[model samples]
Target: MFLDNEDKISIDRVVEELENRPELQHVYLHKLFKRDHHKGQRYHEKQISLYAEYDRPNLLPFLRDSTHCPLEKALEICQQRNFVEETVYLPSRMGNSHSALKMIMEELQDVDKAIEFAKEQDDGELWEDLILYSIDKPPFITGLLNNIGTHVDPILLIHRIKEGMEIPNLRDSLVKILQDYNLQILLREGCKKILVADSLSLLKKMHRTQMKGVLVDEENICESCLSPILPSDASKSFSVVVFHCRHMFHRECLPVSNTVSSVQFCNICSAKHRGPGSAVLEMKK
Candidate 1:
């Protein structure tokens, strides 16, 4: 007596039903994907096989999301079926980006798409490959020229252009590139001015705040020592430091630092410096 797994029989039956009724493949496939998401490798293999044999429009998108599908097997079927987009996407997803980019350049002959794919990947080698492919085609050359100063440099593409070839909208593309460069320079200058002005304005505001006197009367008490900041006797006088947060401490009650420029953190109000607010240094006398 022998026992066998049920998944194989179930998947085989589902595949046959899907193959026999092409109209309901997507619905059943969606159900299979959702209900049996973790139905193991057997489930994914069935999906891959169905996608390769039939031109189910929604097949690749499902395959794209499933990591269980064998990429090499899927690509082979997609290529045979003339599924150009799938072939390109599958190779790229499999890390064979050079092959995918080649198909986009030679097989698809779509200059804009090839450039956009290169930009999205943001690979220098891909840009070089695109530039080399575009060199011989005047229309491709024109398309790349329009993207200069943004996705690519004009010098790189311009020197590659054939001497006798006439590119479409050549003068207009150059003008646009120059305008883009000028606009970028102006933007940088404006940003610099705004940043500097903001810095100066903040500094001036901080100076004014520092100049404003704090009311240190007999009612005031030291936050650190928890004693009267000003003694009732008129003959004696002591120093104190007052923070912008209005926390006061006696000069001798706070910790002493060896570094002259070390930050003085208030023991009370310190929302920025983290820690449990170490004792503040003597800032006022």
Candidate 2:
């Protein structure tokens, strides 16, 4: 069959090509072959017969692109550390194809395989974002909350929506989580945003190389009054306002008198400052 670069290949064209070229029969058979890894034998001959019905070359692109459901299942299985079940049951366009064969040869770990699957399926961005949320990274978690300041409220809302937990207790628990870790379970679909000031502070802190202790050791610094804050569960998820002068205080920690005018008394140094509040999201734990 004479093929043109611009011609769209359909199932009819694929059938014509396969019938005309005897060599393609081997390629078709190779694509459908399923080997039993443990016993070193092939699966039932029916598996190939079943696959042959839908083996149109033109359908491969669509099948590969429409892999979100299996991708999600694979992610869940990977997170649960069930690689065998995932590899065996998870469906994809390139099932045991040359690319999958290469991946199998590499003998990659589950997470690595997930990453490769994401790349191969062209869903790397989505899977990567999900992995970031699923994996608990303290700094990334804290940084996320510091940006949006939406964790406490949104988490409480989600819990309420789920309706499987006590509202009051869950609200309190979420508040505490927000306060200690600034842990943000990302609710946004595809994009992440955080406060510029908070991000810069985190960046500066991360670049510091002269630390004398463990990186995540919590230092008790009071948000309000800039005083040496004590560890308190009640103080969790409370928003703070930091000044350009490095002065900081809890938005709620400040006296109600401060709201009457732009100038507010600093609880720590008792200094008067003027400017809009610079919201500080705290990550205590």
Candidate 3:
């Protein structure tokens, strides 16, 4: 009769009876939720509170499956009951993961869980808080030391460990930290060696290319003055500069600048003829 929605009297009577049994209220609510989900939304907050009030085992499951329950109110209810799991979960679900982690460390006292939570959040502030919470607590310190080497600086924890504290497996933790440092050093050395080898290979290639030099004959003309770079006299004393782009210049034809920090240009090159080659030369003596 209570299953039939049309039988308001029977449902009302059963609801009144179940009200006297707070433990069974959530069960009835879950039944109503199963029968008609849209209708169940109206009772969602009530069901959540009932589960929290009775400290029901299926509180988490109920929360996971239900919607329309105000999370803030539920968080308040769970906190008042000191329901560690729900309190932590509610805050985390609301994006307050730090508060959840705080509860996990302070109330649950599970170092592994706290570390994993911090890792999942991957926030710097959260990791720092975790380290701060673990300080002076030997077991927590040991747990953090065993882990977090690759993810965080071990020195942050090592230097902060209390002077008189005792940590089990402290030797193992130290060895792991040393091994991590040695591995990092080896990786850096390997990268440096690779870079040096690459540089040497590039230098050798450049040397081979330089050996096959530019051909200079009498026909080459100066870009600045449009005059032949090499005169017909084979024994003439002359100085010429040949660029990689094959533009040639007689030493005396190009104008020189004495200013310490100014661009080198040629009024003749611009006025006479120019090439596509481009460069900025800075000379300091």
Q: Pick the candidate with the highest TM-score.
A: 1
Candidate 3: regions farther than 4 A off: 1-25, 31-39, 53-55, 177-285
Quote the positional error of residue 225 for candidate 3 in Å: 42
Q: Quote model 2's TM-score.
A: 0.18
lDDT of 3 by residue, 1-285 (tens): 466744565544666788878777667777777776656576678777788766468788776666678898888788888888888888877889889899999899999999988888888888899999889788998899888887799998988988878898999989988898898899999999999999999988865664455766678787878888777777777776554334666767656651212333444344222232222221111
Per-prediction TM-score to the true structure, in the order listed = 0.65, 0.18, 0.52
The per-residue C-alpha lDDT of model 1 at residue 44 equals: 72
RMSD of 3: 12.8
Question: In model 2, what is the error at residue 133, expressed in angstroms?
Answer: 91
TM-score of 1: 0.65
Model 2's number of clashes is 9
- Tell me the spans in candidate 2 whose CA falls farther than 4 Å from its real position: 1-217, 223-236, 278-285
* Residue pairs in candidate 2 whose N, alpha carbon or C atoms collide under 3 angstroms: 147-194, 147-195, 179-237, 180-284, 180-285, 222-229, 223-249, 224-249, 225-268
Residue 139's lDDT in candidate 2:
31
lDDT of 3 at 251: 63
Q: How much is the lDDT of residue 79 in candidate 2?
A: 36
lDDT of 2 by residue, 1-285 (tens): 222321575434554466655346434433433221222112223222222234434223322333222344333433355344334323444343334423332344244444444446554343434234423433323333332233123342232233342233444544665665433345332134546667888977754521222221235454555454433566555554544334555555667986534566666666666644322223332
